[model samples]
Target: GLLRIDHVGIAVADLDEAIDFYERTFGMRCVHRETNDEQQVREAMLAVGPEGGVVQLLAPTGPGSAIAKFLDRSGPGVQQVAYTVRDVTAAAAALRERGLRLLYDEPRRGTGGSLINFVHPKDAGGVLIELVQPAGA
Candidate 1:
């Protein structure tokens, strides 16, 4: 079952500039940042407010990167909506059972050492849905 919305992912041309804009405009506090080589992205997580919403900003590491492709196609906007799950494997299995296709055959590493998987956009009304199991869970 889904726990809550983990974060909303936004693809950006530059991570540092996006972080600064979020901080200055929305006052979102950046809580984590990392470069995921496998994912080929430089990402940052920002805390939205006192109630704990989060926004993830992602920038491409190279022209062949997924973020770069997304930027070329969509022009740098919302990329994905992530949901917190207790067990990503189980959630993926369940979604599969319902005939929804996943982007990965198995879970992969996500922000903050979390396990993650995605429901393919084609299977979910063109919205990329990410399932995240927190680091320690």
Candidate 2:
């Protein structure tokens, strides 16, 4: 089952610039940053408040990356919403059994060593949904 809100992802053209803007304007703290080669994204996780809300900033690694396509089609903006889950495999299986289409056949490596998978946007309204199983959780 889903545990809680993990992070809200936002697509950006410039990762460093967006990190600077969020930290400067919203006072959010950049808690983690990394690049996922397979996913073709460079991302940063920002802590929003004392309650532990997170906003993820995602930038494309190249022109052909998904983030780049998202930027071209929609401009920089909210890209996906994620939920933390105790067991991503189980959660994904449950969702699959319910007739939802998962983007990947198996969970893929996500931020901070976590396992993650996505539900097709077309299967869940127009919003991309990510299910995250936190590292060591």
Candidate 3:
């Protein structure tokens, strides 16, 4: 079963620039930062408020990264929506059985130590859908 929204990912050309804008506009502070070399993206977590939702600032590290392509084609904007699920592998399998096109055949590591899989945009009404399973199973 799906739990809740994991977090919303925003693609940006410059991570620091985006961080400045968000902080000035929303008064949010950075809670964490890390680079996922496998995904070729650097991310910074910003707290929306106290117990508030988190905002992820993602910047492509190379031209081959998906975020790089997104920025090249559409500029900076909301990139993907991720939902927390109890079991990503099972959830993906079920979705696949229902005829959803998956970006990855299996779940992969995601930010905040979660397992994640992406449902193709073509199968998700043009919006990329991500299923996430939190750390420690």
Number of the predicted model whose TM-score against the real structure is largest: 1
TM-score of each: 0.97, 0.97, 0.95
Give lDDT per model, in order. Answer: 0.95, 0.95, 0.89
Q: Tens digits of per-residue lDDT for model 3 on 1-137?
A: 67887778899989999899999999999888889988899999888988878888899999999999999998998888888899999999999999999889778888878898999988888888889898887
Model 2 stretches with alpha carbons more than 4 Å out = none
- Per-residue alpha-carbon lDDT of candidate 2 for residues 1-137, written as tens digits (9 for 90 to 100): 88899999999999999999999999999999999998899999999887879999999999889899999999999999999999999999999999999998889999999999999999999999999999998
Per-residue lDDT value at 101 in model 3: 91
Listed per candidate, the RMSD to the true structure in angstroms reads: 0.8, 0.8, 1.1
Model 2's C-alpha root-mean-square deviation from the true structure amounts to 0.8
Model 2: worst 10 consecutive residues (lDDT sum)? 45-54
**What's the residue-level lDDT of 65 in candidate 2?**
92
Clashes of 1: 0
**Clash list (residue pairs), candidate 3:** none
TM-score of 2: 0.97
Candidate 1 vs candidate 3: the TM-score winner is 1
Model 1 clashing residue pairs (backbone): none
TM-score of 1: 0.97
